[model samples]
Target: MSEAAFETEPVPDRERFEDASHVLHGPAGSAAWRQVLYALYVVALLSGLYGFTVTRAVVERYGQSWRAAGAVLPVAAGGAVLVVVLLVLAHLAGRRRGPVTPDPAWVDLVVASSVDRWLTLRESWLLPGLTLLVAGGLLGGVGGAALVGGGATGPVALPVGLGGGLLVGGALALSWLSGQVRADPSGPSRRGIGASLGSALRMRTALRGLGVDGLRAHSLRAARIGGATFTADTRSLRLEVAAPVSRGRRWRLHPGGRVRTLLRRDLLGLRRQPLLPVGGALLVLPGALAAGWVVAGDAPALVAVLGVFGLQLGAGLVAEGLRQHGDALGAPRLLGGSVRGQALAHSGAPALLLLLLGAPVAAVSAGALAGPVAAGAAVIAVLGIGAVVLAGLWLAAFRGQPPMGAFGPNGGPTTLLLWWAWPRVLSVAVGALVLVRLARLGAGEAGIGSVVLVALLLGVLLPVADSALTRAAAAHRG
Candidate 1:
């Protein structure tokens, strides 16, 4: 055969391989349509419910403000914040399991063969991208409907909202693809946004250069992680997603007293995973802002509930030491202290971090939006709430596996979910209740003495709860 003919022959063979693979492995025609229809039905139901409930209520309450001049700036700012958050999350998720992850079997067979990698993987990427696009459009449509119902805008908003959502969704899809390319071990070195975008847009060409071995390894890892998730094997899931410690490796821990050493160890850990503190700060800032608004009476007490959840998540990130301790419950204690003592020592870093980060933001937001009195109260409230949230995160960190009964024949997914989530839920509920009662007291609807008494009661209760959970987890581990 001629050299050119020999070189061109493999291209057709690769195309044929992909075509046959799709015919053999892709979902059946009616089944695929049924899946699509079911997804649409579910999305429509959710959008309808949201439009009639939360969206409508929000639009009714803030519609006039949304229509006022300069409202667009704040709305745009919030949207930008959300976009940044989503992009960060997407990048992290890509590091764990990228957007184009295929089945382990597919990777072993087709991907390991002579077929074009992009030909085999493009479908996997397209499915998720389209799903995100549809989801975004539906969300926007629901919001647009709510705005119209609340008289915030005209019928024109519907198409505009949908168009905007499509654009946002497309951007998100591109970001996800960029993350996948960045995560590829044999791909080009990390580059600027323009470079990433250029790579994503020409993904087929990019895939041609990716190492098949790396893709296979990642595919297998993704499968194992998926299995862990399905079985609720939190430890395995955490291990799978835990990035290697590459930062602060040269930093040495100093010798000190036991408690001091524990605190330093956690701080060192945070230094190693430097992004944890950054992510925690991002979460805490908005939470603090919401909390300030609630405390200053600029927003309803219900807003504090969201703030409590955000604070808990943020604290959880910084409380990795506590979680690691909990995971080591059945093991020997090299740290030479009781589990509870070590746990409390571990809690110090997160609590202090929360206070330092939350207090100033809450104070400023309240002072600027309300007044000096509210600012003082907001600062105090933020500190208290941060402590409460930190304690709750400590409890959640130690919450061991759910009881077998939760997954027994009598129980189901809902029961197991609730069992796993109960600690965080209870903590948020209690925190919100406290904030609401305090708000009422500030508004002169309740007596200070009673409010303080309730506060004191809760302050005692949370520790007892945390201790009980720790003991239970230890017992379960034993």
Candidate 2:
């Protein structure tokens, strides 16, 4: 080869470095970043307009002396302090184990190579850091605005917000620092020493004094020498570790029949892997109940809104249960039956469970004023909501390929606009109407006919629609 040709050739090291950098940081980083920026812009613009109007409305209602708005500050401050303390302690405890271990590829390719560790690792921390900073800033801004609007303090409000943001930001930074310190290979010996000393501190006495012997046992450990490093005992560390658990027991049933076979397997799967179902219920049910209770006194219409929302939450759990089976769509083909019949068989357990769970909550939420008959109607309506939710989720799952654009693998705002979300929204609107009718029934303005009508529409009509939709979707796919 000519000298000129050799001179023009690209360096192998530079080429390899570029390839490694792209893999570490993600090839689509620029596009993803742009999308995030656009999303933020849209959110900011919408929030600014909505917040301005809301602020103006609040000001007009209570003037600058809106002290009621500040009533929750003391409570909020206490909660914030408690949360921050818990986070810090949890973070510290996490550090005892060491920072998150990198992926096998990242360890083998990036760390073992001559490349800078910071460059490869920065991508992991950058997104989290930005998220924390934004969250802190937004929380501080909101709290400050509320305080100022309520006339809690004039000049102090802005400072308070800034301070709050800084406090949160600092906490996050400390957590990141702890992780980095743990990850540093050279610091393990020093960290182990610190752990040993910290383990011996008067904190144990304080924990005993506070009557948290369990915590004391978990937090502190006797020192042990493992090679050159002195570290806390592993027994105490093991005490702090938690294992995942299921929410319910598996049902034992004769598996001779096809339906029974399908149900038995599904029930077992759901009971054994109940985390998602239980977690979704726990996360959503309390908020729904709280909202229902708040509006229970106003009128049934408001309570009905809660009912709809509550059902939606419950529906999500049912859907999760169905998903656990892994045979929702294929059961028809495997078992040789009509799609609709198989779908119904698959959905039976979830629907029954939903009804069982929703009945009491619905009755209580209707209040004593609802009387027995109206209360019965409300309970039935709630069950209907569950059925609808189950049906909707079934259709969404088997009706076609799960939506791909927004909610598919990369979840985003588009997920909220899915066919699944639409049913919840529609349920709320329908609930308002049904609740208004129930309110009239209780007051003697409407007859028993209204009660029966609502029940029929919800209990019978909705499930049929759901079954039909599921069958149609299945047929289309076939």
Candidate 3:
């Protein structure tokens, strides 16, 4: 699509929110809950701001020392303060003088009867860990390497290995537990972390639904909705409705032309920062080429391996970009629904970048410029598709979406992973599968590898990407 056309895709804010599929509320809801919740929310806000301001001042004044630690103290304190705020908000939003929203996935908490419950953990915990783990691991590796080089040994490898093992083991346990619980017929209809999360989500959804009706789980005040306007002093969420709308139903495509346009104009705004993946691939090139050389002497194999590394790097960048996109797109809704767009936008840059990275590398290795160029182009095509699927995951990042924690979420070491990071995983998995299978095909080297690589991009990555984006876009409303 042309840039102007793509950029001008007409979508508006109110329309966007109205078109939102599964609106959700929190547990402990009602009219009274809103007053108390908003108060606590304010408190959390103040605490967070104070913590950030103080932390910044300390960091500016003191070189990364006790001052740094001191900075963390307030943020942590503020976070706790906010937790209290959110809990209260949940209660208060429920208590609003009308029927609160309801989550759709009230089926069984295991798989998320609705998307709201699924996404809570992702927002609360999953995204942070996903963003942090690789960085932390890279740091750990750097630290381990540095310590070893500087003459520290006994304590180093042991922790790395043991810690890594524990992390892996914990993930396995949780995953196994999930399967086991889900398999059990009568064991808490919802299974594993999903069940508990589903319960929480159900509470939010139920709250909104009930809140709209002017009743709360515990509060004395009642709320009522009339036409598009709520009662005075109700302070309920302003929900826009089209004609034919009724109680307990979702908002649809009507929010007026101007609002719809504004929403699109705001979120899809082309303003951007330099994409990180371009730099990432360049950075990883040297190491990847070296690794590729060692892995296989075959020219095609080497090129293919390079493609994998490119995918990995691209995936990571795309993941980060998507996150930032969410930060931007979500500002208006606050519900975090536009994360899907973020994913789409973020992934788009990296997919292009993968082509940039792959084309030259593939051409150089193919013994001929044409071969390398073709290989690189193929690599881009494949990863491009993968990027599309990756966008599905961005939807998964929102407040009510599913928590696809990378390693699973028990607060164990493994919890520090992004389960929603499918693009990265898909890229890696596709690269490996193609490389391994093609390596065996053996046209002595280059030809077989090229064919295999192309196959993967065409057969695996592209299709999956299309499928993922479709699902994510459709469900993002939830």
Candidate 4:
């Protein structure tokens, strides 16, 4: 055919593209089926082991406690909270890496071509959707089994759990797809739960309407992010995920003392990124409540660990100043302050914010769990834990790139992950240990002297640890 005639010819349909893609990418053969079977086998094995070994014991212990306390309302409330959180998380994740994101090369070749997106990209959507559906059903079935075993519900709970979980998982998947659609700059402007659901139902049409330019850009960005993840380059991954500052530009910092100036700088940065502090508070509030419950001896040791993790994450969000300083540690002292002094200054805003946001919640939770008398102690414990966690974040922030040895033959991905996570692990471990010990001591009616001794020991250790980490961070920069 002549060049002009070929150019004017009608474009191939989605089916043609789909066939071409499958041929190009190679058809799934016996090896693929084998891998799928192996994965299913492993999952079944693990599920059986857990169901036989751990589920019964855990159900017996917590199920009785829950039933004794008339926990129907509490369980429902917790489930609601969990659902909201998961949905929100799913939306955020979709924005970052959507369910329909195929490889960038695939986008450049197949997706960018004149083909119906719904037909072309439907596989990507289907895989995640089916996975979520199955996983949710499994989880729900497990929960139902636990409830039945615990005598909290009848045998009818099994089907109900399975159905409920499937519905929830589908909802989550829809929310995720909605986030991806919303992230498209040229897409619809309407937003909210209704809009989200509508968009999810119409996702195929939505994808079709989305500009290839936007998809290509997002695909490229996602590709870069995936590369960073594969290489375990957290710094690059963080940079990739961080949105540019677009708010609070009108606000200016006034002249003040060095420490005050630094604190103000941190606050102003937070103002620009209002979500950071808001998200931090959201996490911190719940974490503090959990911590208070643990301290009041109303929750298990595992709760303390979870609480510590939440607090650590929350604190990390607000400690961007520390991270920035750590990133620039090797650079010249632009602020003309000592490293330790600057580190301390960077911590001030997070400390104040944590105390203001977390303390009241902790106090109230403690009061409710163990009477008003424990409220004051809970407040104290939160402050202490916050301080320790803040220091740990500093340590983590300053932990420069992993050493070369971490990726050596003897050391592997696990070692590298451990190296990167050591500071957070240590911090969580220490905080949980402290909270668990205090809970035990209170339950045992320990003497005031013992409490004071523990307090004094922590006081001495925290600063030393912080200082050491600060110096180490500086040295790494050097």
**Maximum-TM-score candidate:** 1
| C-alpha lDDT of candidate 1 relative to the true structure | 0.74
Task: Give one digit per residue, the lDDT tens place, for model 4 in 1-478.
Answer: 8999998988669567758667776675224335554665676577656863466567767766656655447648767887887888788767766677766666777777777877667766776776677677767877777777766679998899889988988988888887777776677665565665587888677667655666766677788897786566876787777777878889999859889999999999999988788878877877887887876775756678888888888888888888788777777777687888888899987788768877788878888878776677777777777767876877777666677766677866677788878888888887776666565443456577757766875786577667765676658666
Off by over 4 Å in 2: 1-42, 51-116, 143-261, 287-295, 299-307, 321-337, 365-378, 402-420, 439-464, 467-477
* Candidate 2 to truth, TM: 0.56
Question: 1-478 in candidate 3: lDDT tens per residue?
Answer: 9999998997654443333332333333224435644655565465345643553353344324323334336434644553444333333332232121222232223122233433322222232222233333433344344334333344565368346534533333233223322333344444455563343344333222221112121112212243112212111213221111123233233333443443433223222312233345553353233223223333333344445655455445434434444333424544234444444445554444444654344334332323433444333334433443343333333223334452244542343234334445655555554544433322244465566565656575555555554554455534
Best by lDDT: 4
Q: Candidate 3: where are CA atoms >4 Å away?
A: 1-278, 287-310, 318-346, 365-400, 403-423, 435-467
Q: Check candidate 2 and list the clashing pairs.
A: none
- lDDT per model, in order? 0.74, 0.49, 0.38, 0.74
Candidate order by decreasing lDDT: 4, 1, 2, 3
Worst 10 residues of 4 by lDDT: 28-37
What lDDT is reached at residue 400 by model 1?
68
Query: How much lDDT does candidate 3 score?
Result: 0.38
| Per-candidate alpha-carbon RMSD to the true structure | 3.7, 13.1, 23.4, 3.6
Model 1 lDDT, residue 32, Cα: 41
> Which TM-score value belongs to model 1?
0.88
**In model 1, which range of ten residues has the least summed lDDT?**
25-34
